[model samples]
Target: MLQACLNGGRMRDFHPALPFTATEIASDAALAVAAGARELHIHPRGPDGAETLEPEHIAETLQAVRSAVPGIPVGLSTHWRIPPGGLSRQEPIRRWTTLPDYVSINLIEEDAEDMIALVLGKGIGVEAGLWSVSDAQRFVGLKDAAKCLRVLIEINEQDIDEGLRAAAGIQAVLRQAGSTLPILMHGDEASVWPIYSEAMARGFDSRIGLEDGNLLPSGRMAGDNAELIRAALALAPR
Candidate 1:
């Protein structure tokens, strides 16, 4: 399914167009869904535009977005920057029952396994994020690889060519793993469209949004999440 990453780890200082408040995220979620996104991925932010895992903020954000686009699967970011690690952040994962349909976990983080276990225990899907080929290989080595809810292969790069190579390397690792777990591939910045096209060609689902790029494939500043979604749909394989 096509998922829209409304906001990521970045602050508004980096991209003023980023949706920080619940109202803005909800509005963008509605627009993205209308434009063909079947799922949503959001990173809730506090008033100062920093990421947060506070139950109240998460609850309000999920409620607002889900209310606008009913039944659409909404995922939350379990990024280390928000809650860091250890017993303290455990409450956020436990409190997830109050909000979110799924939560994303970075394979490179120290507490990735614990977080994954927590999410699975709670009956919530885990969107395992692999930023590099090594991360993918590490994930493949895990005993519960197939048990994951979903895997998102995020190619991090500023240049399109390099991103394509990175994605290719990740696919090779997955092939070596000898498993057919559901995979979603996408890239950030200048690599977004190139890797997205590669995803379509490689027969994998992909994602697009302001978190991936503040501008459209044409390099023009996107007016909203829907605009980015429309641009991505146009590039999907026919």
Candidate 2:
């Protein structure tokens, strides 16, 4: 599946077209879906334009985007840095009146297992984010790894060759651990398109959006999330 990561933890200064509010995110989501995005990934923002895990902000973001693109699975980031960890990070999720279809939680975080269990207990699916071989090993060690919706093989490495090597190492760990979970591979900035193409070539799911990059594979600046999705689809026909 090609997931659209509409707006990550980026501020408006990062990109003039980056969506910040519920309405803006919803509109961008609809456009992305129209351009062939099957899933949605977003980072909800508070009134101050900062990423927030507050229940009200999350509910509003989910409602607006889901309304705009009904039937497409929508996911959110549960990165620990949002509230800087501890009970404060988990409390807001517990209090969320509206839940997303799933969420991505990095396995490298301190309370990752607890967060996964908490969200699962609430009946929300999980997308385990594995950034390195160690993170992948950690994910496989979790008793609930099989219950996750999928595993995100995130390559933060900027060098294309190194990024692919990192992805391979992470996959090796999962394979050794006998994990049969789905994989969604992605990279950021300079390596985004390369990793995405590799994911397609490997027959794994991939994603694209302003969060990962603002340029097309040809190095031209993309107009919006929809344009990015279109370029991603053109990489390989499904």
Q: Best by lDDT, which number? A: 2
Q: Could you estimate the TM-score for every candidate?
A: 0.93, 0.98
Displacement of residue 217 (Cα, Å) in model 1 is: 1.5
Model 1 TM-score is 0.93
lDDT (Cα, 0-100) at 208 in candidate 2:
97
Candidate 2 stretches with Cα past 4 Å from truth are 84-87
Candidate 2 lDDT tens digits, 103-148: 9999888899999999999999999999999999888999899999
> Pick by TM-score: which candidate is best?
2
lDDT of 1 by residue, 82-116 (tens): 76445467676687546678888889887787778
